[model samples]
Target: MPHHPDLATTVRIRLIEPDETDAVAAVTEAAYSHDYELPESYRRSLLDVATRAAHDQVWVAEDPATGRILGTVWTPLPGERISPLARDGELDFRLLAVAPDARGRGIGAALTRHVIALGRERGARRVVMNSGSEMVGAHRLYLALGFVRLTDREGPVEVAPGRFLDLFAFGYDLD
Candidate 1:
């Protein structure tokens, strides 16, 4: 439960450029590990920003004035396996990250809204996403954006040999 100041007014959502790949990966890994330690598999996935950008849409929330990437999100386009969380007919946004120091600036929400808009533009019937149960702030944001708790999709996944993470799923119907 970190407190972020309200500063979404200055963030701009855009696709990440090739030169910014390392920054995007670093931000994503840092954001997720803020609450818990990441396992090897999870770490590998987070570091694979380039592969994700090649197959799907990798977006970042940037500070227009400073050209800093404050946040990042990955959207799975149709027929692309950008994320295991996404299924057919839906756009799944995964690995949403707002830098620890940048949380209060509304960067996470901006990246999320950008993904939802991408879903609509791709003619998706709905939007889907998965978040760690410990991410209370992100959960609140998703609920406020009209995403509902999909209890049926909730489950525990082994992130490491003896450690498991319970994932919470949320969905927003496009209708």
Candidate 2:
């Protein structure tokens, strides 16, 4: 596949540093809170970048000019096997969020492409993820990037007691 166009030239996508944990959490929580009714456990999971970075590669898209975080995505690396969503031969990512103010600026798409690239580099046969069903804009972006819905894997994931979010699974076959 040809390289995706550089959608946001001013934003640099890289592994976030330790000092930027709070910033990353703020951006992720702010973004997710806008649409998802996050329960306390899920909220804590989103804010715990350090735990994520311990096993997976936690990346962030930052505006180089201001060093402000625009978005974040997590990719499970080989051997860590920490993902609850990825099946064998699939690389999984979670908590892909772009700051509310950064929507429509291509930040989310850029972050998605970055994860796909990482998967390819690591010899992963496919990239998969589960997204909330209500995220129509994110669904559109994933479809535009050539992801296909895996309805067989669709189900409800409980984020808190008695509260569940219907998840739509998507996959990009690298082979």
Candidate 3:
């Protein structure tokens, strides 16, 4: 399918590859700031898993003009946390991010839909994601995309002063 012309004039979504690991990391670092402090090792591990040929599936949105990665998302099949409602099949969207400069341009929404489509293609009956409380906008987007909040848990790990954010778990039935 062609890229959404209205949102990303010359952007295209493609499966992420090993060579694009650095670009994916760059986009992740640029998209998330002050919210979560991911250690270098954690980032490396995520990238490694995302690029792995096994169960991980990563996708990227590239700007045809600059040939740079504008956004990316990855799903881990056979989710880590299995909910009773997701016993059939599910795809956990581990990460969804768009470059700061690429925000408000529908890039995030496009990437999200792309991931959902990917899940459906992989025979997933539902798509799940964990959104931090600090990501209000993202939570709103998920809601708009028909994702319903299943539950929320207070983060035990404190990253900042007195700011104990909660992780809101959202799920979307692909059927």
Maximum-TM-score candidate:
2
Question: Model 2, stretches more than 4 Å misplaced?
Answer: 1-8
Prediction 2 global C-alpha lDDT: 0.86
Q: Candidate 3 clashing pairs? A: none
Q: Provide the lowest-lDDT 10-residue window in model 2.
A: 1-10
Residue-by-residue lDDT tens digits, candidate 3, 1-175: 2335676476789887777777787777667753567666555654563444246666788888888888888765444432222444777775688888887777888888887887788888888777776788898888888889876423443435554445777888888
Q: Write the per-residue lDDT of candidate 2 for residues 1-99, one digit (tens) a residue.
A: 234366557899999898888999999899999887887888898889888887678899999989999999987767445546777788888889999
RMSD of each predicted structure = 3.2, 2.6, 5.0
Off by over 4 Å in 3: 1-5, 34-55, 77-87, 152-165
Q: Rate the local accuracy (lDDT) of all candidates.
A: 0.82, 0.86, 0.70
Scanning candidate 1 in windows of ten residues, the lowest lDDT window is: 1-10
Which residue pairs collide in model 2, if any? none
- After aligning candidate 2 to the native by TM-score, how far in Å is the CA of 95 from where it should be? 0.5
Candidate 1 residue lDDT tens string, 44-119: 9898999989887788988888998989988765656454666777888888898999876667776777878887
Q: Rank the candidates by TM-score, best first.
A: 2, 1, 3
